[model samples]
Target: MSNEHITTGQAPKPVGLYPHARRVGNLLFLSGVGPRVAGSGPNDSAVPGLVLDHNGNFKEFDFEAQVHSVFQNVKAILEASGSKWENLVDVTVFLVNMKRDFHTFNRIYAAYFKDNQPCRTTVEVNALPTPIAIELKCIAVIE
Candidate 1:
């Protein structure tokens, strides 16, 4: 089956050289999304923001805020591919400090994925971009 790349205006632009999402057959693969804003438009500024704080290094990062931002980013990609969160099959959550932020992460995560909780895996890592706490990548099916 042929594959297609998906992009949307509603989410933050990819920080590096990568498509937001790609579809092959009935599966859609989404890249990890962070809290940076692509821009208001083509000529606007790209704003890079924080998502967590470790000691004084990751200061200004907000757990809930970044989680919501990641969801919005995923939503934009999914919608572009004629899918939604309900179509998600698996999700991988990466955290800088799982012990410190697991509870807060679950509380905020529940809001976005209320009913059909997809298969998920959460892992603690040593660090993230600019010391951010969390980053999420997912896979979903197109109807």
Candidate 2:
């Protein structure tokens, strides 16, 4: 089957050389979607709840705010790719500070995924490409 790269002006411009998602057959593979804004944010949500200095170091951290914002960004990507949140089959979440924020993140995540549950794995990493603390990579069936 042929695969097509997906790009949407509605989502944040990628921080690197990658399309927002890719489609093959009836499945859509989303890249790690962050809570980044397409344009400048006075709240600086490009990394949700993260206030990054010019050097890409965190100036503040609000785990709760970041959690919900990340979901909103992912929702936008699913819509842009003609997929739905309920169609998501798999999700891999990256967290920079699992010990400090996992409980709250999990709570927020459960609320967002209350009705539609998808298999998920959350892992802690040292960092992400951007200053953000969380990101989600998912696979969804485009129905």
Candidate with top lDDT is: 2
| Tens digit per residue, CA lDDT, model 2, 81-129 | 8898899999999999999988988888888889999999999999887
lDDT (tens digit, per residue) of candidate 1 on 1-143: 95988877777666567778999999999988665554333222332455233444544556776677667777778898888889998999998888888898898888778986899999998876533567788999997
lDDT of each model, Cα atoms only?
0.74, 0.82
TM-scores of the candidates in the order shown = 0.81, 0.88
Q: Residue 108, candidate 2: how far off, in angstroms?
A: 0.3
How many clashes show up in model 1? 1
Q: What is the lDDT of residue 70 in candidate 2?
A: 71
Which whole-number lDDT from 0 to 100 does residue 71 have in model 1?
A: 77
Q: In candidate 1, which residue ranges exceed 4 Å CA deviation? A: 38-59
